[model samples]
Target: MEVTTNTQVNERELWGGGAKPFSASYGKIMMWFFIVSDALTFTGFLVSYGFSRFKNINSWPIADEVFTHFPFLHGIDAPMYYVALMTFILIFSSVTMVLAVDAGHHMNKSKVTFYMLLTIIGGAIFVGSQAWEWKNFIKGEYGALETKGGQILQFVNLENDKRISIQDFAIGINSERKTHKSNIGLWYQNEKTLPKITVEEVKKGFLANPNLTIRTEQISENGQKTLLSRDEAIYKIDDATGVVEGANLIHNEYGNRLFADFFFFITGFHGFHVFSGVVINIIIFFNVILGTYEKRGHYEMVEKVGLYWHFVDLVWVFVFTFFYLV
Candidate 1:
């Protein structure tokens, strides 16, 4: 009788030599390592943001109110529409990347090239959309007043239940005050560009517009900003110390300064990643056209980048949910 001896190899012990541990190539494994590390970094940022937001829940800005602008639809309330569109485009780009990688697997160079170009175009559109959103965020539409307590006060129309721009009602009081020039004043410090309307001007305007009421950043139990009575509004206007027209590291017209801070840091970091992925996709795109990967007899590079692109898309889902939806 001839008996066949079965060899049962220990998988972990066999892969302990640090080569293709999980049936993945060196480049693919390295890409996964990078993705895991990056995921942890993003997790930390979102957690910090979560804590900060919870600590100031009542004072936090409403996502719907703050992000209301849409491209070429001025004065129309399209709350979260543009942001939703951006998310959709990013997700679609991920789909294109998957197609590109699949095509590369079959050595279909033409199909790979087509899908990659689509992926790049989608990425570029998302990047451009983000810049537009940032522009609207930095250059606020309706201006606000900052109180001595470092909180902001917005103006909303009692008649229409909508926000009103400071410029629409602010009567420009003649000011003898001029922006300080270092040469004419203290030789060391030059004043930054002054706000178009002063706090005093906003106060004067508030007093004149009986239909306009003051809205504080503090959210009521009903989840709306605590609107002040006419008397309270008048009293609150007196606490105004400076004019706030937009968001910055220092102040935010929307609400708590921390919101803007986290928004810039987290979103900016993710934006950098998207921009980098686009650049990489473009490079691979050109190489596919030039038959470089075809000569190498494999398209592992495309698969590697596809992993990163998918990771980026997944990260944005969390970001959009926690930061915007929540």
Candidate 2:
């Protein structure tokens, strides 16, 4: 019967052992597997971050206020400008990768080489920019006081209702303080470097200056930090436990400690991926120059790396959305 014979042929074609599913090679299939797994991992992290932020919505740091620094534009308030530039650069690099893959398909070694180099350069710039941003974040701008209850107290000027740096108001009480090391301490505790200004000094300066008011981490109904009256500020400052100059695993001058934790983990993880991609791209760049793919009669390696680069770029879009915009 013709019908039975056609059914057998169809089964053979469908179940063939040598078949490439969806016309994809083994390498592409593996890359897709990796990308899918990685995407799930990123999703879990972002979900956790979302939940934590929701739980601490009142104390969460405002992304715009926190990430306002731009290189060579110190003391200027330019929110999200540098981050937008970084996103554009990364997306543009993805475009270059697409062109590189297309050139590889056509066996155009020169074009592939040019585009790969450009992608590498773009990736390098993004990584460098992220590092610079990290430096500024860790260094901090306006210092805050941490209470015994783990609350942050920032200072603002009543005249302009703007934040003022600790140096602007805090009176310098320079005293030599030694860092606690395991070898030097009886409790075997190791401590980080001391903050430039101490809590005692900030408290002293607060009492001396009448214009500076305390801004609590609690967000009011207007979605702004709660500004305490002069009487309340003086009452609140008495509960000061330490001076937090910047963010770390335990303390964050910005706001909630969890915000800094999620920020470092997410962005640092993404930065690692970008750095790895650049290194891989550089290797492929040399191969393109040396005609290794030409000898093999295929540039599948370039296409494979292009897939990875595209995945990295796509993940960053989600990261930028969650971390910056939201």
Candidate 3:
């Protein structure tokens, strides 16, 4: 009877005996532990993000302004739309992964395969969308000016608060400027090169051309350097633009070098993570097509990669919040 009781207890425990049952395998448990550790690591990243926010409390950029582009809604000021779409795509992939796991439990290889494929396709789409977003970010919509002091000053076309670029400010009939020759010493021929229009000249033309004006020094500097304030705007000639001067960092408009350094470092790190996630997803996707996991009777590999994908998404959430939104 004791032996019978022991056997029954073991069977029950192995199947569904208690809350603290030790029936799960070492591999699955380790995966859960690893996920926990990874969660902590992400938390660390977010905490650091918070620290930076605190440090730059006054100068942080607005996420909404920075990421206002939609997939097709050109000229519309809809912010967070694409990011929301990407978030949904990731969540949907997670659902498909869970469905794949269910199919695996039922021993339905075909259904599991289909769901896995869908998950991969969704991930590919998300990565593609991310690439698009990155392209826009790198190209920048409204370029800013960098100061000699490494500070960014953005120009607003006085009539509109929307940011303007050096190209935008260019006005009528200035003779095309000659490029500075690198080997001026070797080529002594005073080739009658057309005189280049000075930034000062460009500024004067811009002032004369009612379409442009100087952005107030007090108007810009909220991290983004994208927005301009017409209220504080001055009609006075800018020393730099003479035509119209505003401060900004794009095109080294801000003289501050640290702005460029920080911009590249932070964005580059995030972009690298996105690139790595794409490569990893591609590997898992091919594995799904090859039916490798079906033979193994489990698609836990998908689950692992899914965790990583979710992590990248989560990090972007914070980055968007801090860098763009906040």
Candidate 4:
């Protein structure tokens, strides 16, 4: 009995290497890899923002005062309300996406289609709302004076404690104030469009109105902007070198220019993600409608897109916490 024992095994008895690792397909694994890389990118951006904010802690703008506008509620002073609503919309969309994925798992094409449509609608509303917010931020509400050192000085009525717009108090001055056109100025040094009012006009107006006072960008321990006395307000107005009407890459009437820069970049990046997720969802939605996944006997595509949608919603929660709530 020449017994080679179990050492002489047949080739067919050896383990085959055709199975997927962790039972996940290549497409699903690729999506996860992309998400992890993108998350690291967002983390870098947020860390930079946090450091900048801490360095400029005194002059940073208050989120409540900056984002007070709401759709159809002009002059309501509803701080952070609209942002909260936008967050809700995005989270709700994530829920619908979950339903869609679950329906796909069960091979229920009709339910998947219905849930995907709901998710698309929710995303559209959120994107549109974000556009409106950007418009308001750029257009600005109450204008402010920018000091020589780039500090923002807002105006408020001492009697009513309400904000006062430059348009209401600035006295029109007849002078040689002209908009700098590209033809007249240096070819490479084109000026941004001039503000509706001038610094001198604002100064003159401030001197004339005893009831109006200046609010510095510095927040007090009481969580309010530092208000100056009548005399201090008038004295500060003399240092106003320019009038800032709205937010831009160069200037932000709200407060520090860096605040606006971070706001635009971080929020814009997240918005782009949401938009991309919406497009992906729509494509998957159509495929489901056409019985493509039904013929394949699985709805893993819907599950993958669902993961992306959920990630987008999760990122917004972090953004809302750092930018708005905190």
Best-fitting candidate, scored by TM-score: 1
How do the residues 1-326 of candidate 4 rate in per-residue lDDT, one tens digit apiece?
34565444432233356455666777788889988998999998898999999998877898998899988987798999999999999999999999988888888999999999999999999989989989999999899999999999999998899999998998989988677787887674666667879888998888888899999999888878899988888788888899999898889999999999999999999999999988998899899899999987789999999989999998999999999988
Question: Could you give candidate 3's per-residue lDDT for residues 166-269 as a string of tens digits?
Answer: 55665546554565464664665554332233555455555565655444323244443433333223333342431113222333333233333344555456
Q: What is the TM-score of each candidate against the true structure?
A: 0.93, 0.91, 0.67, 0.92
Candidate 1 accuracy as lDDT = 0.89
Error of 3 at 263 (Å): 6.8
**Per-residue accuracy of model 2 over 44-123 as CA lDDT, tens digit each:** 99999999999988888889999998889868999999999999999999999999999999999999999999999999
Residue 92 alpha-carbon offset, candidate 3, angstroms:
1.7
Give each prediction's root-mean-square deviation over alpha carbons.
4.7, 5.0, 7.3, 5.6
lDDT of 2: 0.91
What overall lDDT goes with each candidate model? 0.89, 0.91, 0.58, 0.89
Write down the worst ten-residue block by lDDT for model 2.
Answer: 9-18
- Candidate 4's error at 24, in angstroms? 1.7
lDDT of 4 at 46: 90
TM-score of 3: 0.67
**Candidate 3 deviant stretches above 4 angstroms:** 1-26, 29-45, 172-198, 209-278, 285-291
